[model samples]
Target chain A: MIRTAVIVFPGSNCDRDMKVAMEAVTGSPVAMVWHGDAEVPACDVMVLPGGFSYGDYLRCGAMAAKSPIMRDVIAKAKAGTPLLGVCNGFQVLLETGLLPGALMRNASLKFICRDVHMTCDNNETFFTNCYRKGEVVTIPIAHHDGNYFASDDDVARLEGDGRVVFRYSDAVGNATPEANPNGSVANIAGISDATGRIVGMMPHPERLFEKALGGTDGRRVFESALFSVTEATT
Target chain B: MKAHIKITLKPGVLDPQGKAIEHALGSLGFNGVDEVRQGKFIEVELAEMDEASARAAVEQMCEKLLANTVIENYAYELVA
Candidate 1:
């Protein structure tokens, strides 16, 4: 069985939703680990869900990054365990130094809540195995600090290494600057680390895992990631 | 002695609360408002004997909690 754990912080609002998505797609129970807990439950995948953790005080994910459970998450990521973070969770990953760059406030200085289009820039990554290269997918994003920013050199490094897993795209899969909601660098909406085991994005894929909830494409991400895990274990 | 650390977002970054204040000021007939930005001022006290220790302690505070190096920046002043 592919063990999964959804991390829950004090102010996390999407832990259950992420657990549900993992269960529905993986057909297995996902352990809900508390932030105060020092150890993460034994799981092959660790998910950091979205919410206003610590009321986003002192910066969105600053306080949560120092949580006890994050130490385990960081250790796991270093050991090549698959780690995924979404929305404020993404901010946590960056704050933990698991990923690069910071998620700044939206340029418009408003909370953006809408469906955004994304294109797969690299399909070979463990998290994106189910999506085709250049394929377009729409996921919902709701955040005040979703604007992704990195130094110009960092952007070049991500692009040169093909670490940018997804970019904001139009309906036709063409990257459109106008369609970008948060003014992220290079229209990037999602990215993986050098090893591809750590993936973080500002969009809430768990919220769109079901067609009834306005999406089904998001499920492919979990499915693909599970496939990678199952293949690795066998 | 106590120290006050003021943390502020960078210039290019957006500050909604600050913008709101600027708007309110403009509405109240305050003119020549070119820009407005918001920041946090945190007061911390230390009983160390030396200035070097005080500086080191404040730097530690900035890295460990007071400021998030990722997005926000911070500056400190000593009040004796």
Candidate 2:
């Protein structure tokens, strides 16, 4: 069985959704790790669910990035534990420097909450293996700070290394610059580190997992993590 | 001695609160405002100490608590 843990901070509204997604895929209940806890339980995969941590004070994910558990999260990520961050969790990952760049507020200066299309950019990442390159999926995005930005050089580097895992796309699955919701440099919706162990994305794949809930695109994320550890041993 | 710390979103990081403020200013008859950005200000009182220690403490505060370095920047100066 693939062991997993979901790290929950105060105000995390999507922890349960992520837990359900993981449970549906792994056939097990994931341990819920708290922000104040100094340790994380042993697990093959770790997920940081989304919400307005610390009331989005100082900045989105700013305070949560410094929470005690994050130190362990960072250490675990460095040790090659598969970690996934979504929405506010993505903000936390960036703030902790686990992933590069930052997720800023939308360009329109309004809280964007609705479904958006995304294109698969990386087929090799642990969080992307289930999707073929260029595959399009519709996932919901509900965030104020969803704009992804990095230095010009950083953008170039990410594109060069194929670190960008997903990009915003039109309803037809075409990645058009006009479909960008937050003025992200390259319409990027998700990215992974050079090692591919850590992944962060702005869209809420967890929210779209069940067919009854509207879609099953989220199954891909959990499936990729399963492939993560299994592929290593095989 | 007292120190004031200002933490701001780094350049190019979107500032929604700042944008709202800018919008409010425009509605209130202020014009020609190119942009608006929001930041945080914190006041800290410290015992008489060397400048080096004060700077170090402030930096520690940023790294551990005050600012999220990946998204925001912070600067502090002692007063009195």
Scored by DockQ, the top model is 2
Give the Cα lDDT of each candidate.
Answer: 0.87, 0.88
Window of ten residues with lowest summed lDDT in model 2 chain A: A225-234
lDDT of 1 at A133: 95
Which segments of model 2 are wrong by more than 4 Å? Answer: B10-20, B69-71
- Pairs with steric clashes in candidate 1: none
Q: Candidate 2 lDDT, tens digit per residue, A1-234?
A: 788999999989999989989998878678999999999999999999999988998778888888999999999999988899999999999988888887877888779999899999898998889998889888999998888988788889999999999899998777788899878779999999999889999999998888898898878889888887778778
Fnat of each candidate: 0.40, 0.60
lDDT (Cα, 0-100) at A39 in candidate 1: 92
Which stretches in model 1 have alpha-carbon errors above 4 Å?
B11-28, B47-49
Query: Roughly what TM-score does model 2 have, to 2 decimal places?
Result: 0.93
Candidate 1 has a TM-score of 0.93
Tens digit per residue, CA lDDT, model 1, A1-234: 789988899899988899999899999889999999999877889999999899998888999999888988899889988999988889999888888888877877889998989998898887889999999999898999888987777889999999999898899888888878888888889889998889998888888999889888788879987999999989
